[model samples]
Target chain A: MIYQTVIGLEVHLQLSTKTKAFCGCIIDFGRAPNTCVCPICLGFPGTLPVYNKEALNSAIKVALAFNCQIQEHTKFDRKNYFYPDLPKNYQISQYDLPLSRNGYLYIYRDNKPKRIGITRIHLEEDAGKLIHEDGQSLVDFNRAGIPLIEIVSEPDLFSPQEAFDYLTNLKSIIEYLDVSDCDMEKGSLRCDANISLRKAGSLELGVKTELKNMNSFKGVKDALSFEVGRQAELLDRGGDMVQETRLWDAEKGVTVSMRTKEGAKDYRYFPDPDLTRFHINQDMIERLRLKLPELPQEKLQRFMKEYSLSEYDAKILVSSKEDARFSEECIRIYPGKDKKLMVNWLIGPLLSEANSRKVKISELNITNDELISLIGFVERGEISGLSAKGVLSQMIDSGKSARELIIESNLLQVSDTEELSKIIESVILENTKSVDDFRSGKTNALMFLVGQVMKKSSGKANPKIVGQLLSRRLTDA
Target chain B: MAIDNETIRHVAHLARIDLQAKELERLHVQLHEILGFIDKISNLNIEDVLPASHILPISNVLREDIPHTSLTPERALENAPSKKGNFFSVPKIIE
Candidate 1:
């Protein structure tokens, strides 16, 4: 139908503090369900919810990391709804004045950064979990009263891939800030995407459906793709669309209408009487802003400039905080001048090992010392490049040192000039034409002779040593 | 300052209060009188005055992020009408 898709995302991040937001109850997930409840969190009468200070710090850090404007005067509101998930009949969330607003996060689209606008970030208390059993539902109050921050984005994305990239970059920023657990499988990080389609050139927006329950980033992307097609077909048939909430069924790969959205008035949002308004001071904002580390974009640029890595390699390294930390450590501690050697090992052999093991590079448990020493084996020509690859594979599997594995497997390179010269002399007799070419100043022929020696030595001859010896033999004779 | 039956019924529904027809009729008049008394202030022009929900002029009350011992599960579920395995059982409200 040639309609441009308008997408905005709202991400709910659980603050990684030790306790619940309003109370001092331990927020230990999966600790026998209701064990974490207390009078404040359970909504017992005469109880007041106290704001968690650490949560404020984390939220301010995240907002600052994304370049948000921290509001000086903000307040919480009561969103009234009758649901079992919320132990209290109403949830304490923000209404008009939130903690921060007007932030922008940069996402790479078409090899250039597209600045996605962040509408606002507000702190709220999470609800409990309701498990629907045979007929009735069971509620666990453990998760209730946990601190959560709602990050609302502007409708800046146009496609499903753009939404996915936005989410990926957002998660990376969250990890760099180290605020939340940032795990989707565990529900620590959750996202709700609102997407609408309008005529290609029309300025007005179409009725957008709010999508929820996407378990992963890929699930969100897939659900959006499905929604795009579904909406386009309905529009093509000139059918009317309604604003509603839909749940993404990952198993069925379709979005089912959950409920027609009730207008905001239905919630009857009012200023929360129990919790008073917060006057966010400039000092707190400046402190949190100072606490923000080098975010993904700046770190990506620095990785390229400082380490001489390509834009592609730098992005891969800085995609996750773990990857960036590991690569940065290895680069910092690397004995050689060329940091690409360390980066190549990180993005190449170690990356393949991580993929096979189904983990991130940081989780592979190979310390930077171990990785650098393994790379050093290749740099010193103690192990041939081909055999070094084998040693690296076993190093991760067996958790052994590169020297130990090389010695045990007898895979050391023939770097000894005396031993390599014999193979070099035999190769010279075999390739007399290339030898004459080298004598005639065809220096490229030297590389061919090194390859011949390496082939004779069963790929064990270090090419560097063979070249040195071959040059000495041809010229000194 | 007028109160209608539909407005009274919606408000009652939102508050989860069961109101009889006779009570509804009585409240329709009673609520009108209540609003009429409060609406008398509308005649006074107070544009410069800032609206305040709470009389106190304080904000930013917060607590440290340290955890304390939580209540035992038995005490937590003690007031529940129905319980199942440390959970409060209720009618299903799934969408």
Candidate 2:
């Protein structure tokens, strides 16, 4: 029987706040083991927690961006647990009343926007780090008490790719808003996935397995794929599925059982007495809603409709804020009838070079005007497209103009009809057999002659002019 | 409601506790009392009202892409229970 895989993701994003969630301690990562700790963060006796207003405001902004309905009154709850990483022995999170609910993020898959329902987006304090040594354990409080907002998605995803697309869209929106860095490698953005397999026509959900410890988005995809296969295999053999929480082993590329699933009462969740119930007023919500910039989806549509870019090109450009801004800056500097040329260069050579050097477009020495000038040189046929690549590298390295680099490197295209005619005549004389084949209706031979002319000119010849000249010469013979 | 001995034991095992037999009897009564109070929440008409997940109405908090200083090896290993040179030491498992 064909089975469908149901997937949902819980993404925990560390808010880009300057201080701890409920304390004034500076929220700095990579600090000394206990340096960032204070009475409030360390959970020392006789210390009372005072909530940071900035953290609350930041969480509000994220909730509004996701189009969640803001609650008039909300409070925090203490989740009881006995983990060494949790210094307080209980994490302050939302239980019955979260700040935001009923939100949806629209992700484009296969050229259509798929609305993925967001179950909830709640604010909580992050736990500490546990370093496991030889037969012993140690703790670091640097990340403790940091503010985290966990966004839970409804079980609307159908496949592993949809889950991946949902995550990519979520990351882009969050990064564009300057909320969290959303760097999965750095653990600022963590994800947990719940997957189940049921018959294709079934409406009820099957027993789901929760996957954790996925440090990257690829890990999430691989773990979900593995679980889907594992669950299907079990159902094929007529075996019962166990609902459990599993940890993703990235190296082995499999999900291992961690523990049986627990319900809400297992955590002993209760309203946190140390914190007060806060209210979000209409003015505050309106102000934040107005402050929200054009999100990634809107920007992507504009790139497609207004700029006339391909879906693939627009998606790549709008994936990251830096790349999107860089492309927009290039467009603004070099407005023309053919905008696709600028889009191609921005997505192709520029992105390839940036990836190779492991640097962002902003980090490159090439400015918008330099890129515009480089593309302009190619558009005007002053330099061939192949020669413009060399010019771009030179511009990035030496910070020179495309025009200056063309002159300094002697890369002017052989658009001089007189000079190109000499190279074409030499090619025709040497490759007499190819010329004969061209006359005999071997159309590919004509392209070979054009290539020979381009090779003779060191890729500095205009391909269109060479083709036209070669065809004209072949016909005359 | 009557508290059952088997239900209390299952709850303790689910919570990963090694509760003694005597403690199970006491927990049976306490859990019954707690569930009775929680039953009050089910009585409210929360079907139409949306479930609240977060307390604040915020979205899209982000940080600048600036490379802050990273923890040095010394600071990273300062809290390690065992260390060998610059690396954290772990128990050997392979032969």
Candidate 3:
């Protein structure tokens, strides 16, 4: 029997607020243990949380961007648990009412767009880190109290690749909106996946397993792929699936069972009394909607239609906002009026150099104007393409102009017809056997003679003109 | 309403609480009363009403990509109960 895997992702994004969610403590990462903590975040006996306005605004922006229905009146709930990392026995989160709901993100697969529904996006506080030493564990409160927005998606994803694409699109949108860094390595963005397998046509969901501790997008893919196979094997062997939470060991490439799944009643959720409810009017929504910059999808379309770039090229350029901006600047400078040469150079040699140096194109010493000048020089036949590469290298290293490098190296194009004609005539005379072959049916001999003329001129002669003159002289002879 | 002994033990184990048998018996009646009172919510007409998660209509909060200086090794270890050089010290688990 065929089995279909159902997967849902819960992504926790740390908001880029200036302070902690409900406290005035500075929201910073990589700080000393307990250095960023305060009474409010540490959950002191007398400390009361005062919600940060910026955190609320940031959460609203995410809700609106995902097209979720906003809740008019919402409140925070306390989730009770006894974890050492959580200094406060109970975590303040949303229970019955979340900030947004019923949103969708479109994923492109096999040349078709599939809409994945978003269940909810809720706001919460982050917990601290625990570093286990030889005999004991050490707690760091630096990350505690940081505002986090948890976006939960419906179990609409069937394959690992679709989940990967959905995550990529989500990260691109969030980063483009300048909400969170969405850096998985830095823990600014984290994801937990719930997966289950059911009969291909079954309407009921199978016993689900929750996967945690994936550090990267690749980790998520690998973990999900492993779980899918594991579940399918269990069902094939007539083993009953158990509902449990599993931790992904990335190094070992397997999922280990942590504990059995807990029901909703386990948390004992209740409304937090310290905070007050706030409102979001249509005017405020319009203001934020207007402030949104051109998103990746719009930029991709513009790159294809206006710049006449291939789908593959446009996708690569628009994947990162920095790369897209760099490409746009290059096009603005060079204009690509001649054979899309600028685009080729930007994608090829420039990308290679940037990669080799471990830097972005924006960080390169060569300015957009300089690159344009180099392209213009090649287009006008002022310098050969080979010589232009040398000029570009010099421009990157020494910040020199193409014209200056061309003049210094005496590498001007030998476009003078008289000079090139002399070289072409001499090559034709020198290679008589080839010339005779050209007069006959061997067209390749004519190209050999043109190559000889270019070699004699030290690769400075324009190949187009050399070919034309060589064929003209060969036919006349 | 009186709570049963079996129900009290199940709820205690689900909550990871180590409760004595006598204590469970006594708490059963108290829990039953509390749940009986809370059940009044089911009487309200909320079939079509949506549940609320947050009060404010907030979205799209972002931060700029900038790297600030990290905590020094000394400061990072300041809160550790045991320390070895720059790292926190722990018992040896594997031989």
lDDT at A55 for candidate 3? Answer: 76
lDDT tens digits, residue span A343-388, model 2: 8888888888888889877678888987887887887878877778
Error of 3 at A403 (Å): 4.9
Q: Which stretches of candidate 1 lie over 4 Å from their true place?
A: A259-265, A416-459, A463-477
Task: Identify the leading candidate in terms of DockQ.
Answer: 1
Q: Backbone collision count in every prediction?
A: 0, 24, 22
Q: Give the DockQ (2 decimals) of all models.
A: 0.74, 0.09, 0.16
Q: Candidate 3 chain A, which ten residues in sequence have the lowest lDDT sum?
A: A259-268
Q: What is the TM-score of each candidate's chain B when compared with the real chain B?
A: 0.85, 0.52, 0.50
lDDT of 1 at A404: 90
lDDT for each residue of candidate 1 in B1-95, tens digit (9 for 90 to 100): 78789989988888789999899989988999999999988998989988764557878889999998899999999999999988999987763
TM-score of each: 0.91, 0.81, 0.82
Rank by TM-score (best first): 1, 3, 2
lDDT of 3 by residue, B15-89 (tens): 678898678867977898898987887888999977644454443333333223434556556665766554444
Pick by TM-score: which candidate is best?
1
Ranking by lDDT: 1, 2, 3
